[model samples]
Every structure is written in structure tokens, then in C-alpha cells.
Target: MASTVLIFSASLIALFLFSLTGVNANAGSNVFSMQSYGARGDGLHDDTKALRDAWAAACSSAKPAVLLIPKGKKYLNRHTILSGPCKSNIVLMSNLMASPKRSDWSKETIRHWILISGVTSLTITGGGTIDGNGKIWWQNSCKTNSNLPCTEAPMALTLHACKNLKVEDLKVVNSQQIQISVEDCTDVKMSPVSITAPETSPNTDDIHITRSRDVQVMDCTIKTGDDCMSIQDRTENLHVNNMVCGPRHGISIGSLGDHNSEAHVSNVTVDNGRLYGTTNGARIKTWQGGKGSAKNIVFQNMKSAVEVSDVLFKNIRGTSASEEAIMLHCSSSVPCHGITLEYVKLTVKGGSNDVRSTCQNAEWKKSGSVSPQPCSFKN
Candidate 1:
């Protein structure tokens, strides 16, 4: 598994470097500034319409386009969707903030704030901040403070049905819900990104990848209230490397096959992860009575089980917030198989060195110096 990941990482890094170089070439091409379209950049006015117009002009361009949101400006926006099957490659250098007022949102736009959909060969960079202004949303969320009705909140940024996408060198903070969502996309690469939110903030997952393929999330720093990165159903060929996750739930595989539905995910790899004081180290969670296969997953340092099989966790070293540092709760009806844990060492945070492992209805193999012991199936 290590050898395979090394090779794949090498090639994927090369490919992304090449594509990102091409994407940066647009810096010399046409520029469509948001301020030119009547935006104030004051951090108070609604800049949604101006941004929409800028996106329209950029998308319609015959040559590569650059939608520039110049530095040091904090333009406030409402639910904004930049949708396209544009004529050429598009670059969105984003530096913006979202309105904090919950009433400004409606049922139609509550799920997404800055949505970039149906665009191909898109690149988003520009070392700026995307503030979700989530103080109001967090106050209203049922998860944090009870007595409020549970309602859907907006994800700070979403990329839907996009191909050949590259998002890097950005700071995403205080998202109302999930920080960054990659859905139904292909050939996506995100690297050297920072995602942050209060540890008490509700459901602010750093990154969520679902129904996507060939996606790579590398060299990211994440501190959030939810899973640092959640890999959901129908995602394949996904790679996560050199991630720093803490003060949150660790990397998760699935809450898949929910409500007795069938789902399949395969070819996932997570490598060189550093998780500190997290609720779980490597997790794979599948609902009871759910059907589907989650297979060929190699976590060089992670867990989840939707009929999970052929999964490996290697070289994982971290401090677990709970006593059960390693937990594998596979479904009884569809037990997990071919699971392996290698060189895993996890200790409880600020407590005795008596951490434990729990394995149920799963078949596993262990190799090398595992602390708190390793799981072995009962014959």
C-alpha cells in the first residue's frame, strides 16, 4: 500500500503542477474585476449582483478569463452561484465575505453560498480570506444551542459538476456549515489550503467530498467542529496527503448506506496524516441495514464500514480524545473483511496509557508494534 501511494502521489503531483501552471497563465489574459461592475468592496453592501455580472462577462469570453477580486477588499455577498459551461478556462481569484444575517437566506439558497457549478478547467487561488460571518448561524443551530428548530445552513463554498478544477492558497474560515464541498466533480486538486472554525461551531466540516472522482486534497491545515474531511458515497480515486487535523473529528469515510440505501465507494487513499486530540483517528462508519461496498481503501495513517473490505491503516500515530482510540464497528449482517492495522500507536489525551481497541463483526490482520494491542477475529 505504501509503495502504491508513493507512486500515485508522485504522478498526481506532477500532473497538478502542470495544470496549475497553465491555469496561472490566465493572469496575463483578460481581467474582469468585480469593482468594475459596480461593486463597492465595502464589506457592507450586497455585492452579489455585481459579482454575478462579472462572472457572466468572464464566462462568455472567447479567451481565458480572470475574475479578479482584488486583495484587501471585503465584499459582502448573498447566495451567489457562478454556473457555466464557459467558452474557455476560467480563474476565480476570490476574496469575499458572506452575509451573516440568516434572514437574508431562503429555502432555495440555504444550502450553498458561493456555488461554482458546471464549469470545467476552473482554478481558484488568490491568497485571501473567505469569511462566512457565521456568528448568527451558529447561534441559531440546534446542534450548539437547543430550543431552536433544526434547519439547513449554507456551505461556505461548493464546487458542483466541475472538471479539471484546482483550488489552492486560500483561507476559508467560520463557515456556517461545511467549509468547502466538492460534489460531482472530476480531476480536482486542492492543496496548501487552510480551513478553520471554532471547535464548538456546529457542523463546520473542513472539506467534504462526495460523488467525485480523481480528487486530491494535499497539504491542508484544518481545525473545525466536524470531520476534518468527510468522504461520502460514490467517490473514487481520492487521495489525501500531509493533512493536519485537530480540535475536531478526524478524517471519516462514510455515514453511507443510510436509511437502507445502497451505495458504493472505492479506491480511496489517505497518507501522512497528523491528527491531534481528535475524537477519532481513522474512522469508517456505515449505517445498520445499509447495503453497498466500500473497498480498496488504504489509509497510511485512518476508519468507516459500508460493507467495507480490503482496507488498510498503516503508520498511524496520534493522541485520541476517547479511551477507545481505535474503533471498528462493522455491520453484523455484512461484516467487514481483509482489514489490516499496521504500526498504529495511539494514546489517550491527558490520561493513563490504557487506551483500547474495539472490533466487532470484522476480519482483520495486524502487523508490527501496535500499542494497546491489535484486533484479531475470534474463530
Candidate 2:
């Protein structure tokens, strides 16, 4: 019988070639387009050549690409460098604005409107608005640098050495210095990001994660003047959760120094945070002839209202610290070890102490009502 009609026509031609290879892999995975390549949502000038020609057609392909600035208000005069070896995934939706420039202040150079370098697996989510107009970089860094160094410019989303980064639901505004600087990055995940400036904005630190590691900053809302989160150099496996810092300088770790640069901030954890009118709530700073060492840090279930020092650990010598909460002056060749504060609940209306250590195997114990001056255990 013609071999049963040639085995039913070869099983209907192999089921129509497996349904055309699943619709050609969903049509190359639905690569969304804003006029095929070149986007613009006119709101009033400077679209930076249609957003650098839609990020060069979304890094010219390797899959994921959705540069849809669809909602309105798009303006930017200078600085938008996203140099990368990106593998795809860049989505910036909702009222996008990267505006700045009045000749960008005589071009002295420090402009990083949206610079992301050496990326790998990048993702910048929606609810957008990145306006670092910064009053012309804070009136040109207070007229000619005023003896330069630390807080004279540069920063608005500068992520260098990135790898597997993810920044969610953005709303960063008026940044001059340190709005979001994730340097030496690795597997970073910043969630629900909402940072705002101008509480006397100068060196506006909202999120400065340096020498990074497997970091995770969650449920964020940072209002700043400085140090909403400043974990500087040589960091490791850090985690911060349910955060909401204010008027600035609340969560910090180290001003650590002196060549060797050791900062094994092991399994650090800051949870259920909410620090308002902050000037210090949780800190572990090191300086005063510098050397290095900060290990196994933890601050849990935090809540500080009207702070001026719910907790501050400092060490001075230039960088504006004459007196202000927990100042530790370590010298005798570098010493500060194993800092731990558990179940902390602080409230300081007028500055002073909650906990201050001079570092020699420091350990601060807490369960509540800590009134400072007690931690000097070095046996």
C-alpha cells in the first residue's frame, strides 16, 4: 500500500520542522525597537544625538536590548558614556532626563552624566529620572577647587569595572559627587533606588560602594548631603536591607588607609533601616595616621530619629572632623578589629555618643538604651 503512504509522509514532514523552530525562537526574542535605531521624546532640547543613536543600536546585538525612553522629557547636553563589552540588556524607561550643561562650566572636566564602563550583564530598570543638573556642578565646585581633593566633582552613575550589575526603579537627582559610584564592581544589585539631593548638597553621597564584592542594597530611599551609604575600599560580601536614610551620613564603614588597604568587611549586614535627619547612626571609620583592618561588621534592626550620632566611630586628621560622634584615633601602627553592634535602636537629637571605640579588639554590645562611653575592652 505504497508502504503505508511513505510512513504518513514522513510524519508530516517532522511536524512542520518543529513548528518552524518555535516561530524562529520567538522571532529573535522580540527585540523591541524605537524606530529601529534612534530614539527621541522631545521635551526641550539636548537628546544627545538621540541617546547616542540608541546606544549604538543596543550594543549592536547579542539579544536583550530595550532602550525605550518612552513617557516624555528627554534632555542632555553633555556626558553620557556607556563604554562596555556589554552582552545586552539596557532598559531606561519612563520620563528619562540626563540634563546638564551651561557649556558644562568651562569644561574643566569631571563630567560623568551616565558612564558605565566594562559592563557585563547590565540592567538599569524603569521609573526613570537622572537629573544631575547640579547647579552647574555646584557652582563649579565653589570657585576654582578651593584647594582641591575630596568633593570637588565627578559622579552621577559612574560604574567602572562592572559585572552583572542591576539598578532598579531609578530616581536620582541633583548629584554633584557620589550619587551612585559602584567602583570595582561585581554582582551588584541595588533595588528600589530613590535618591534625592539638596539638603545643603556638597559631596552628596547617596550610594558609594567601593572596591566592591557581592553587594546587595535593598528597598532604598536615600536623601542626602553625604554618606547615606559609604563603604569604602576593599569591601566584601555586603548586604543592606529595607533602607531609608536621611539628611545624610548614616550608614558607613571606614575611612581606612595606609598602603596595605585591608578591609575584610565580612558578611556585613544592616537590616530594617530608617535613619532620619541623620548625622550618624552606624559607622566604623578608621584614620589618624592610617594602617588598615575592619572585620566582621554587623548592625541590625536600626531605627534612628533626629540623629546627630546614634552611632559613629571616627578617626581624624583632615577631611572635616573636628568633633562629631564616636571619633577613634588609632595609631601605634594600625589597629581596629572585629566590630559588631547587634539589635541597635538609636535616637540622638543633639550630638555626642551612642558607642565610640578607640580600637584594640573593639566590641560594642547592645540590647537598647546605649548612652556611650563603655567599650574599651582589650583584655
Candidate 3:
């Protein structure tokens, strides 16, 4: 019978040449490959429905999409939300491996394991590795246990209200809390990001910016257990360049007018920093009855202890192992204003070079070398 019509016409021309080599879609070359939307990337299954079906086919593709999580594999997202303004421009690259100990976390699905919200134009680059297995959530911290339930330990990656954001490089490790939380975002730009944890790993803060603005935090290399970078309370126009803070708690701007509230941080700048074995070198901390105003603050190289003020501490040197090496703790009624101390050198460890500095109602002025000396903020 004509050889059964030439074997069903050669199996319909080999299934039409395998759909022309499959999945390029060919409109603007949309590619939604999370292992072809099934992802058994072998970091232990449950690849979050193959990363939520490749983020809904590259977010409802109108083209210019590429949602690939390829490269040695490790996709195990929990509280996922890669929602975006996607009809164009998206290239979420990954090797994301943070599974919150493979499920069973309460309190709203463990807070925020990965929430990339309301995006406009996003670019999350990858060398790959985002694991926040954080030693079983810091052994289920109550942060000291006041009858339990203190820290639910979340935040592995959060960019809420996302605008034009870009997170590059990526080697974020061990974060059970505060690994990267950029809230209410705007033109955000992070560079060569690399954050690690465990200097004790309690409140693991390696970068936590709040109520964001035209921000830029570059060349980041943090070693954490708390505040390698924690700029809080209605931030605006911040820029901190080339940082490498240490064993932890080196960089901080305001435990911010806490409970009393009403805080507003502005026009901040920290240039070329490198603090090691830190405890406090350059600092300003407020909270006596906060209202608003931490103006044009600046830190040239290294240090901090925290508060909010009009700071300009140039060429700041470091070395503080506690007991006042330099702690300009201000705020009786918002007193720290335009406090500029140039070429200040700090030194105090294992006590007694007689190194001292402790002021209240702090207000300052000292040019070139305010070494081991800076007391009177005079009540």
C-alpha cells in the first residue's frame, strides 16, 4: 500500500523537525527555561514548581524575557514572588539555593525567603549561591527568649516596591535574617555584592536599607553578625563606596529614633572604608525624643557606633574594642548638628593608653587629629 504511505509520511516529517528546535518562541526570542519548566535541578527536588513555572513563562512574555536558573543547579525557593512589569526587559540569572530547611516554617510561610516584588526593570546577575540555611535559623532564636517568639528569622532577599534595581555578582550566604532587604525602593544599584555570616550570627545584618531612595552601595564585602551596613528610617540619597567591614557591628546609622519615632536620614555618604575587628570607630546615635533630621552626613574611610546627625568626620581612623574609643552619643533634644571632626584617629583596646571619649548632648568641632581625645558635648 505504497509502503504504508512511506511510513506515515516519515512520521510527519520528524514531528516537523522537532518544532524547529523548540522553545525560542521567535518573536523577540523569549526564553523561559527553568529546566524547561520542570526543574529537577537536584538540590533536593521541590524546585518550587520549577520556580513557579519559570516565573509564569518569563512573566507573560511579550518577549525580551529570560528566566533561566541554570548553572550547577540549586533552586529551592519557598515564599516566592518574582512578580514584575514584564512584557519586556528581564534577565534573572541564578543558582539560588536557600530552602529554609526543606519546609515546615510557620508565621506567614517564614516571612520572606525570596520576595522580588512589583518590578519595573530588573537585572539580578549571578555567579550563583544564595543559601540562608543559617544554622537552623540561629538555633531558633528568641534573641534571648522572653518566653519565645522573638525573631522568626527571614529575609534572604527582599526588594519591595522595586523600581530600576540591579543586584550583581551574588554570593550571599548564611543569612537567617537581614541578608539583603531594600524596602520601598527606587533607582537602586548594588555592586559586586558578597555577604557572609557567623561572627556569632544573631541578627545577621549585612545590608538592610529602609524606605529607600536614590541609593548606591558599592564594592560590598561584609562579614556579619549584625550591621556591616544597617541604614534605617526614611533614608534619602545615600552613597557608600568600597566597604569591607569586619567581625561585625562596624557600620550603623541610627538604631534610629526608636519607640519615640519620627526619624528622617538624609544625603549620606561614606567614602573608601575598611574596618577590621570592629566595635566602633566613627559614630553618632540618637534617641532621647526624636523628631526628624540627620542631615548631610559623611564618613571618609572607616568606623561607626550610630545615631543620626549632620556629620562630616573626615579621614576617620579606627580601633575600638569598647568602653569609649569614640562614642558621640547624642540626642537630648536633637543636639548633634554639623559635627565635623577631621583626621580623627581612634585607638582603644585591652584598655589604657588612657584612651577616652564619651559625650552627652553631643555637639563637636575639631580639625586634624582629635586622637584619643574628644570628650565635652557639655550638658
Candidate 4:
């Protein structure tokens, strides 16, 4: 604990020193305040333009700039972008307030309400909350009502093609779909954050990472309807630790091999996870008739996909009320192979007394007290 405090203190000191330097491209930090450019922050009228202007100035600034959204303020916005290849390092500190509403977003691209992209060496730190007003979207979702046509809803926050990114101390709630998504990026870190939504809110995963590499997720609490963390195709070298998940699906890897499409996902590690009131403890699900290699995945949830392969799970302890405590529903044609388990203990919840492991064409080298055991039978 002392060492952690010292490290944090040192980081603060370094940042403070950096802030005190004169504004220059290579040496100092500048501030671009949203209020100075005319942000109402009243939560009524849209402050999109003001925030955009602040972002524009910061993006083109000659020095490292802080695009600051002050505390105790609620900024309303429509679809927004903070794209960059700025002259120097950039910091985005905002209280992401509200997302723009839409009747139907079926025709739009996956552009989030707040999209951050094309930036290198960026820091995102804030103490404010992002309210995703997902009530209407949830009511109209096709997950519970199959009669309605399936359509794509926008994410609350998205980081696209960003390298060396840091997301710290943020609260995201009630997203229409995926709360936070990172795609096509590298060297990203996220920690000490909370993401939440109602258990009945469909398709609202806490964090979804796709086609990204060298990412770290730590000390996060996620309570949502879908997977706490969903790992998709082309994602490699990922690590998640000190995670708390509840009232949702546990950490999951892929519904890969979709449409008989080939996918590659590898090198993932999930350590020290706590799951409660979830549907599945740890899961790997894939679709049939698809071809690809999904090797070297380390750990955890639910969602549909094509193929699954090579993964390791270790040191995961939790309670599961669901009958299928650990689910490894793999494809028959391309059966899951090279799975490894160690130090995983999941006890049955409630008084039912029947908690089983379900494995369909799943294989793993097992160790420790993994409930229902590994690769033994399918329920």
C-alpha cells in the first residue's frame, strides 16, 4: 500500500511539474476550457459546438493541451468527435454528461456519441459521469421482443485507432448498447472505473474490445446485462485484473467464427476476478461451420461467435447461481483445444444444489477445484 501511494504521488508530482512549464509544443501544457468558448453546461441547450471548438483548438494547438470540462457541470451534446494527431501529448478531462437521442440508428456507422480517434499518447481522466439515457432504446430492443427488427444502437463512448491511450477514473452508466468500446488500437490502459446498467437492459456490455492489442484493464466494477468484458476477434495480448462483475454475464471470449468467417484471437490473461449473480461464471462460445484460430486467450462470458481455440484460465474465484457454472460450448467441426485451467473455484448459489459444467466439444488441461470439472462432460 505504501509503495502504491508513493507511485501515485510521484505521478502527480510529475504531472504538476509538467503543468507548471510554459506553454510550448515540446515542453509545456496548455488548457482549453469549454466554458471560455461558450459552453452553457445547463443540460438543456446543446453545448456540442462549444465543446467541439475547444477540441479543435486543443487538437491543433502548438503545445500539449488539456481539453478540460470543468466539474459540477452537465454538458449536453450530440454526436461528437475528438480526432487527433496533435502536435504534442493531449489530455481529455471531461464529465461526459449526456448522449444525443435518436429514434432509430440502423443506418448509421458505429460512430459513438463521443468518438476519440487517430490520437497518439492521450490521457483521459475525469470524475464525472456519462448518462446514456438508454431507456427508450431498451424498450425497443429486439432481444426480449423478437418481433421487432434488429438494428444497431450507438455506443456511449468509443476509442478508435488510438495508440498509447489511458482511461482512468470514469463512470459510465445506462448505455444503449455497449458502454465503452476500444477498437483497432494498441497500448491502451484502463483502470479504477465503474460501468453499470440494469440486469434487464439487453446488449449493454460494460467494456468491449475488438481488433486491439497490448491492452490492460484493472480495478474495474461492472454491473450490466451482458458480458462484463467481451473479447472479440483479432484481439491479442490483453490483460484484466482486480475486476468485480455482478448482475450480468461473466467475462466472455467470443461468439467467434461468424458466418463461417475466419478469426484470430490470442494471448489474453484475466487474473483476480470476482463474479456474483451472473449467468455464467467463465465462458467460451463459438459458432459452427467457421474456420479460424482462437488460441492463447487467457480467460472469461456469453455472446454468439464462430470458432474458439487455445485459452488458459487461472486464479478465478466466485459464486454462480446459474446451473451451468462454467460453459464451454464450442463448435463440433472445429472443436476447442489446448484449454488450461488452474486455481478456479466457483460454488453453487441458492439451495438448488445442482451446479454443473457444460462442455460441448471443449477440451482443457485442468487443475484446482473448478466446479463440474474441465473437459469431463457436457450438461
Candidate 5:
């Protein structure tokens, strides 16, 4: 009896050890070991097949699929499309290298190296770099010399129609267009994202969220050419917090247009942000004849350096053309309401008005002032 008891205890211990080993194997850094399916780690080899196979294997198991790029350099000559009805989380973790340029912008065609579309419950978290290798593309735009229709093209990371998405701890630099774009997505969270683009790079808005709902963007540093963050067309339940924006227009809502699709943006809050050298600190710009509404929006605890206005509303119809910062150029059909500003401090180095709003039923009540404004300005 004593020998049998001892034997049972030993068997249990062995079983536990085996289970631990299996877990470690499955959780092993999911590192991309090769450029192809069978090859070893040679930077020159194309490891796309290896990455796909690893993801397939992890997906088959009920575990998170981590497509680790490791520490070195991996090149992608073509677009990586992440289309999903995936059961497990897909992660692209790596210090990826941009594809080599063939020629000038004429032959430059690397669109969306990391494209995540039609996915759900995906989290892209890593401390790595995604370089767009955008020098040649920027040169092409400069050569064309046209400004109206900005020549910059598709973005580096495009998340379209994805839900429950989380993108964090990534450094994106030198992208041809927007570094990260979230469109028609819901329940998304983007945090600790650092993006850098040349101040003169046209149409390089760091993050543009459109037609999305229940989104949160926090703890980000965005330096770009266009609006650092632009929310347009049917974005609701949005929250932006603890951000730094520079070398571009500050946070903006709309350029909402006429005859285009219309959506409501409500319950949006932006708080605890710093803006430097931006065209406008906080702005709401709508076109002359759009059929949409912006409401329940609040800006709190925002500081701007060298901003055009602390708060601006350009409602062309209600206020004088030059008097409005929150412009409501919308046709009589569309209405704008419930826009609020609270606890905002701004320093406008250039000479411009401090506050402007022109929505028909808009309300502005805050305890802040511009340097040269009169003491009795209120709305």
C-alpha cells in the first residue's frame, strides 16, 4: 500500500511537468524564425509564407496567434492583408523594414503594408517600428506641386470596419498618408501610440477616425501635416485623452459636407491634451451645405501653444463670415447643437480671435480668456 501511494504521487508530478512544457511550447515567443516556410532567418529571404503558416498553426489551437517579427529586420514588398473571421487574437509584433523603393512616386506602390480589415477582438501591441520608407513618395508629391487635392496616398495601418480593436505601444514614422486610420469601426481603443511625420508632409494626419463608435484614443504623440486627429461623419461615443499634437491643425471635427453620407457625432469628449504650433487649438468646421449634426461634444483641460483659437466655430450662416470659429455652413436642413467648452487654456502667439461659434442653437460657457480679448465676451 505504501509503494502504491508513492507511485501515484510520482505520476501526478510527472503529469504536471508535461503540461507545463506543452504550455511553454505553445506560448514560446511565436517569433518569425524565417522569411519563407522552410528557410532560416536570413534578412534577404521573403518570410511571408512562414508568417502565414505560424498564424495558421496558432489559430488552429485555441491560443492567441502572435506573428512575431523579432528584433532584426523583416521586409514586406507587398501589402499584408489581415481579413478575419478569426477565433484567436492576431498580433503582428516586429521591427518591420519598409520595402525598397523602385523609382520615384510614379512607380512607388506600397499601399497598406499592415492592413487590418473586417477583423474583431484584435490587439496590435508592441514596442516596434513601422517605417513607410516615404522619402521617395514625399519627393513625388513635391515634384507634382499641386496642393488642392493633396497627393499623399493610402496609409500604413488601415483598420476598416473592425470591432473591439486595440492598438498600442507602436512607433510609426514617415508614412505617405495618415499613419493610422480607423474607419467605420466600433469599440476601438488606441493608446500609447507615437507617430512622427514631417511637418510639411501633406495630408499626413496621424490618426483619423471616421464613422466609428465607442472609441478611445489616449496617451499619444502625433506630429503631422494635417489635423493631428480628425473625427468626421457619424462618429459617436468618442473619447480622446492625454495627447500631444504639434506641427499641424489641432483636433478637428468635420469639413462635414453636403450630399455626402451623414452621421451624428455625440457624447465626444477630449481632455488633458497639449497642442504646439498648430493652426487651431480645437475646431469644429462644417461645409456650406451639409446634412448632419454635431452635438454633446466637450473639450476640457486642453492647453495649446501658438494656436489660432482656443475654441472656434465657423457657422457661416449665423455669424459674420469672419466672426465664427465653430462654423455652421450647413444648409437649413441640418442642425448643430450641444457643443460645450470647459477649462481650456490657450496661448495664441499669432494675432487671432480667441473664441468663435456660429451654430444656430450652440452654447459656449467657460472660464478662460485670450490675451487681447475684451473682458465681456460671452455666448
Candidate 6:
């Protein structure tokens, strides 16, 4: 009886230790380990096949699965997809690094490094790093040198057509282009994520949201070459709060309606954010001769005339890199109205605190210690 009790206690202790490794406790023996599938994880060997095999086993399992790419080893994967409408909920805990050699990537996959699609009720929470190893691609870009041909570079992580997804506690860095692309997804939440790249790296946006709805991004730190977060056409019900953005373009609503295409983006909110040393604090850009409407947006910092209306900017205080701290460049074809600014303050960077405002085809109201004042409504 005493020996049986000691064995039982040891089993419980082992299970408790296993739970701390980020695998689901309910997953039990359904943990598909990449190493068990023959991944060397030595940073030199290609782990793509091992990773795919692990995913396939877990994705087909009738029980809840945890695809474990365990820690303390580096894994190199080529352009890979962990695609599924799996039988049960899945968790991917990984420390995946992309192959840096241009020869390793095929032309078809030059646009994406790691693609996760069609998955539902998925959780990707590992305090692991997804390194793009992008310097080789960046060196050959047209933006690096005009003499080079403009070619497509890969986004480090692309989550497409997924619903009820949660991605948290990951560090995604050094993509050849966009770091994280959330496209055609719904009910997604990303929090406490770190996305970073060199400011001189071209088009490396931290997070790009497009055609997704009911998405929330909270407690993120983004410093990148392009927009820290760019909300594109048809994205609605997005909430971004408690974010720190810097050293590039700040949060942007659009370069929407490009090529005369119809774009519609609405019901967006950004609150409790800070922007420092950015090219634009908060901006909206829609091309001329484009058809569509961007409305019902609230930006705490700060448009386009995709018919922008019913928007509010509250508690936006920052140092502007441009002399024109507030620019409301609305489209004349469809003017913007019902804009509000409250407790706004902006001063020129590396200069006197004085700044100016510019407005065209926009009507706005201002209150509560507004500096640089509202356009055509000076105190």
C-alpha cells in the first residue's frame, strides 16, 4: 500500500511539471512533438517535414491536441502551412525560424513564410520567437536600392480565414516585408505580442489587418519600417488599446480604395495608445477617384474622404515629426463631417512646442485644451 501511494504521488508530480510546458492539460498523450517526428531542431537541419508531420497527426486526432515544438532548441522551417479545420481544438507552441537563404524559398512561397489557415478555436501562446531571418531578402529589394528589381518578399506570419483564434506572448521579428498579416479572419485576439524590425527595412509593417472583423489587439509593442498597425479595406469592429508605436508611420486606417476599387471600413476604435517619433501619429489615406466609405471610427490620437464621418480623437498627446501636427485631408468629392477632437496636444519634434494644423474638406469640433487647434475653428 505504501509503494502504491508513492507511485501515485510521483505520477501526479510528473503531470504537474508537464502542464507548465504550455501544452494543454486535457491533451494528455495527444501531444505531437516535432522531435518525435524526426526534427533535429539543431538550427541547421530543415525541420519542415517534421513539423508538417506533427501537425498532421494532431490535426486529425479526435482528442484535443497540442503540437509541441519544444523549447531549448532552434528550428528552421521553409515556407510552411499548418492548415486545418481540425477535429478538435488545437494549440501550437513553437519557436520557428525561417530559412534565410534565398535559394531555400520557392517563387510561390516568396509571399509567405508561415501560413496558418482555416483553423478555429486555436491558441498560439508560447513565449517563443518567430525569426524571419530576412536580411538576405531585404538586401535584394528595390527599396534597398533602386537599381534592384522590385520583387515580392514574404510576410513572416500570415493568419488567413481563421475564426476564434488567439495569438499571444510571441515575438515576431525581421520579416522581409510585413511581420504579421491578419487577413480574412474573424473573432481574433492578439495581445502582448512583440513585433520588431529595423526602421530602415522597407514595408515591414508590424501588423496589417484586412477584411477581418471583431478583432482586438491589446498590450502590443511594435516598432517597424512601415505602419505599426495598418487597418485596410473592409475591416470592421477592430479595437486596439494600450499599444506603443514608434520610429515609423503610426496607426493608419487606409490607403484604401486603391485603383478605383470600392472599399468600406467602419466601426473601428483605438484608445489608450502612445506614439513617439512617428512619421504620422494617426492618419487615414484613400486614393482619389475611389469609391467607398470609411465611417464610425474613433481614433484617440486623431482621414480620407472615403466619406469619413462620426469619428472622434480624444486624449491624443504626442510629439509630431511634421510641422503640420493635425492634417485632415478629406476628399472634396465626398467631404468629411461630424469629426470631434478632445484634449488633443501635439508639439513639433526637436523644435519649439509650436505646431500647425491643416484641413481640407473636413468639418471638426474641438474642446479641452486642444493645441494647434481645430482647422478653421481657432480659439
Cα-lDDT of candidate 6: 0.80
Q: Worst 10-residue stretch by lDDT in candidate 4? A: 7-16
Residue 158's C-alpha lDDT in candidate 1?
Answer: 95
Tens-digit per-residue lDDT, 1-379, candidate 4: 0010010000000000112122232336788888889998787878889989998999898788888887777787766778888887888776655554564233554446778899999887765687777877787789968999887777888999999999877788888789999999999999877998998999998889999999999999998889888888989999998887776577777777778877778998877676655666556657777667777755532122234456879999777877778888776534676787777877677645477777777777776556568457322
lDDT of 5: 0.61
lDDT of 4 at 289: 72
lDDT of 2 by residue, 1-379 (tens): 0010010010000000011111222344334433344544464566666666666667666876655554444545356676778566554343445455545533455646677788787667666677676766665665336664334465777888988888777788888677888889899898889988887777778888878899899999988677788888677888999987776566777666635445445567888777766655677776545555676777877664321223433332122132333433332222334343333332233443333323332344444333333465322
**Per-residue lDDT tens digits of candidate 5, residues 336-355?**
23333433333222434454
For model 5, give the 10-residue run with minimal summed lDDT. 8-17
Please provide, for model 1 over 1-379, each residue's C-alpha lDDT reduced to its tens digit, 9 standing for 90 to 100.
Answer: 0111111111000001112333465345788888899988888899889989999999999899888877667889999999999999988875789997888999988999899999999988867789998879999999977888999999999999999999878789999999999999999999889988898999998899999999999999998888898889999999999987776577788877888888788999988876655766566778778888889988784222234678888999889998888888876545778888788889999856989888777788777777776466432
On lDDT, the stronger of 2 and 3 is 3
Q: Cα-based RMSD of the predictions, in order? A: 14.3, 25.0, 24.6, 15.9, 20.0, 18.0
TM-score of each: 0.74, 0.29, 0.29, 0.71, 0.66, 0.74
Q: Across residues 113-228, which tens digit of lDDT does each residue of candidate 3 receive?
A: 78888877777775667887778778768774446677667888888988888887777888788899899899989887888888887888888888889989899888878778
Across 37-84, the per-residue lDDT of candidate 6 in tens digits comes to 999978899999998999999999888888888887878999899898
Report how far off residue 216 is in candidate 1 (Å).
0.6
Worst 10 residues of 1 by lDDT: 8-17
Q: Which of the predicted structures, 2 or 4, would earn the higher lDDT when compared with the native?
A: 4
lDDT values, one for every candidate: 0.81, 0.61, 0.71, 0.74, 0.61, 0.80
lDDT of 4: 0.74
